[model samples]
Target: MNGIILASILLRIAGVGYSLVLLKRSGDRRFGFFTVLLTFMAARQVLTVAGTTGTGLEELPGLVVSGLAILTIHYLDRYVDEEHRIKRELKDTNEELTIFKKAVEHAGHGIFVTDPDGTITYANPAIESVTGYEPDEVVGENPRLWKSGEHDQSFYEEMWATICDGDVWDGEIINENASGEFRWVDTTIAPVTDGGEIEHFVAVDTDVTDRKERQLRIEDQNERLGRLNRMNELLRDVNRRVVTTTKRETLEETVSERFVSDPWVVSTAVVDRTASGRLRTRYVTGDETAIDAILEDTEEAISTLTAAVDHGRTMVSEQVKALSNDDITGDTVGVVPLSYRDRNYGALVVVTESSKLFEIIDHELRTELGDTIGSAINAAERRRELVDDRVTELTFAIEDADAPPFELAAATESDVHLTRTTTDGDGQRIVFLKVDDVDAETAMTAAASISNFSDPTLVSAADGACLLRFVASDTLADTLACHGATLEALHVESDTGDGEIIIDTPVGNDVLPVVEALSSRFDSCELVGRQEREPTIDTAEGFRGELQADLTDRQLEALRTAHLAGYFEWPREHSGEDVAAMMGVCQSTYMQHLRAAERKLTTNLFGDERTSDRRPAVA
Candidate 1:
């Protein structure tokens, strides 16, 4: 019995090993079968061995029963271990799935999933809030249902092209919701890919309608403001040009031409202040009849404008009832003060039918225009004064009066006393004479004693002085001859020194020979001066003294000789032929020199040719 038990144990172990191999291959719970086989093998072996090498049927039954019982216990233990491991794995997988689902559903931006044909497959709750559509309603519907059609076809074309290329499309879009209300959205659509091929599209969007509208309004306002600024700049440029011109006609024309299309300017006028302190219209644009009537009643206009000025304000009136009997319709008038140096000069009246036209006429523009008009008026007045002064001086010089009297006294008592007198006829004839230095009676006796003094008559006599007037032929030559006599007889009791004198005379061709003779005689002792006086325009080319009158060649030559012989010099100096050549002429041929020399001499002796009439030639 002990040997049988040992063999049965060995058979049970072998059977369990074979059954374990079978269960491992079958992938089923075969461990129980393996244990039973092991028990049967052990029992069989024991029975055989116990029967002394003979088979035993009763031993086989006992061996099989013991093997089956052991196999069942082993197989059951293996199955229990596998079941516990599978349960643990299943629990972990469920936890991970729950986390993923929560993440997808709770995203902030409204997320949408669409099929390749743009059909909405899924949408988050955020989509309902943004588009006013429930997730169920949007799903399976074309995403284009939300399109506002505000975006052009090209816009959608580009969007679809980008997505089909597996690229993300990001931009602004206008969309319509379930309520048919339009809205702007900032959207991003990206293609979902499966194995590198686009499968569907996912779009995330946010509402941006309010921000977009605000930006557009701001842009429009900026554009309008920019246009207004440009208009103001143009107006300023026009104002600058208007203020710079002084001519009345030019000013009016410029203003009318420039502002012809301007709604504020119905007409333009330049009002000049008269000597009587009343304003008169000098130039005007538009209907002459109206302008004439307005100018005729300037006092009333002035009174109205003055009231406006007194308040230092612009006057706006809808009707001319205050100045005219007629009711002027369809007109608005703005009267602005024109001032210079803070003093009122005149007024500018602008007329328009539109009240808004005056909106641009602010204080700054009014003040600037006022200043410009003032400056132009002042400049015009100065030019007038200058012109008048010139005319006065010319009148005096041409008349050949005794050049008023020399205000400065002579430096010496011995200086020759020069007296001037005019002839009775026409009074164009002028003569200078010398009288003996003696008491009046003695001078008269001496003058009566001179037989050469023709028609000698006493013009004036006083205090040892006597003035004798006589008609002399060739008065200029006679004057020079008398000066020579005075110079030669200086030691004589009644001598007046070498009578080196210049004569103011009319120029003519016959005067040349007489001038040459005088020049030869008075080569050292005295000098002769010749001058021609005539009326001429006070201009650069027409200005001259001796040559003032139309000159003859001979007369011009005579004048030239006189100029070169120290006649026109400052201290009465001389430079004969050499000076004449330097003046671009031969000594005898002095007409050309006379013209140029006279121009220079007159400019120096008088003033510039432009203002030459204002000054007289030095004695």
Candidate 2:
């Protein structure tokens, strides 16, 4: 029980305790190595205390050395365990860093880091493709280098404010590329914070140029469609007004008002072509300032109007400036021709603040609206003529004419008389003419020789006079019809191409347009006579006498019954059977009489002198 033995024993116990703690904590087999040395030292101390070996002092050196050895092995084992733990931690850390590096380098979105002052410190590989700049080029520069100037300084200030407050900011940005082209990017910026203070900013950007452009294009197309729809609605309204209005002035005012009502049209003025070929503003509507602006540019306005009326074309200009001190600016002016079937009525002047109006008023819309209005005006003139008792008759002598009647008379040396003129489905002029001193074959042959005439055929022949049917282009009848006039008589003298044209029209109707048309087609056209007279109609007794000569009593009765019963009215007021019942006759018999009566009336009105073997003209 000396101090050496006691100390050795104590040292061995301490080593054992330490080894146990290490083993419990690490479960490493190396921790048991210190236990084996402690056991050897304990056995030596036991032998010296029992005196089975020399005294404890003699074993003391061995014990001391053994204790030291035990101490060294214990500490070494602990050191080795600590070394293994450090190596494992280092390995795990290296693996995690590798994974993070790979993710950052290969990310699809552009990733960039900037220092606190907004200078770019590092940029990922994807940044080059998105920004069109190399990583090295941008590393030392601020992100402002690629700014497209599309966004104002306030935009950047707001973004910086949000991110610097440790809040993320996201928006769409237009940035410039290295080649001076612009690109769109969806970007998100977040501040990297340390202890609630911003250290750096990290930005992720995705290229969205194609998608943004497509969206913009779609928006533009939608705007155009909207404008077109508005214009189409205005045109539809004008057509509706034309159908219901029976006065030229009323129709012009209505159309002008309709145009002015549109959002795009600031003002409208309808210019009329007078009989003397002079232009006059017939109706003006809408904003007074815009109208004054158009009037200010008098020369340009007149030129556009004249071109529309004379050339049958639409003229548009953006150079028409708005009046001074007016709210409107950069106004557009357009003149659309109003013409139909070789007749020029006038022009429609439209003033608009938006150029989009011109884009919508394409050629098709211009032509359709112009022709519709022209036809309506002509119809109004015709209605006025039918209702008015006073009529104006004009006679013109045409020399060197190229019409069928003139050519036929010159070629056959016969007097040609026009009996009737009409238009067929194809718009060709179908004329019936009576030629004296020529057979049917001779008259048709002569008519067929004219270049403007086609499909010549014989209608009938009696007493050395032949009724010939032919189709002609650019005839006097067509010209007179276009100007709301009716051809009363047309004759060509024998052995000469000179002809006389007599037309009847409303007293107030302009006669110059038709005369101009006639002059343009003939070498020498002169107004031979002008007369005003009251219109005359046959007395009822005389009309009844004429019908009595051509219609049977039963046919006349059937005709009179159907007419009074409103059978010929549109969506007929009475059916044929109903008319027959009213007449107290069987349906078939009454229909027979009605058909015969219609045939007689048509012949009486249109002059049917057709031969038995002849067919109606198809032209």
Local error of candidate 2 at 322, Å? 3.1
Question: What overall lDDT goes with each candidate model?
Answer: 0.54, 0.79
Best by TM-score: 2
Q: Which stretches of candidate 2 lie over 4 Å from their true place?
A: 2-12, 20-97, 152-154, 164-166, 222-234, 273-280, 298-301, 323-326, 390-619
Candidate 1 structure quality by residue, lDDT tens digits, 1-619: 4544554566566656666665665445556555565656665565556566434444656556656656654566566556656766777777777775565567666788998889999898788767889888899998788888888999989989999999999998889988999988889999999999888898998888889999888987785576457547646765776667755446556654564346445555555454233546656665334445455655555555555443345566654443343533225556666655534545666555454455555657666666676566555545554443321110001111111111001111122334443455754444334343444455445444443335556655554445556554433333433222111111111222223333332221122223333444343322223334442335555445434454555546657567557666777665556555655667766645466656555554433323234423221
lDDT of 1 at 527: 26
Clashes of each: 21, 0
Report the lDDT of model 2 for residue 269: 85
Best by lDDT: 2
Q: Estimate each model's TM-score.
A: 0.32, 0.57
Candidate 1 residue runs with Cα over 4 Å from true position: 1-104, 217-619
lDDT score for residue 526 of model 2: 87
Q: Write the per-residue lDDT of candidate 2 for residues 333-416, one digit (tens) a residue.
A: 888887767777778888877678888888677878888998898788778877876879888898875656777788778988
Cα TM-score of candidate 2: 0.57
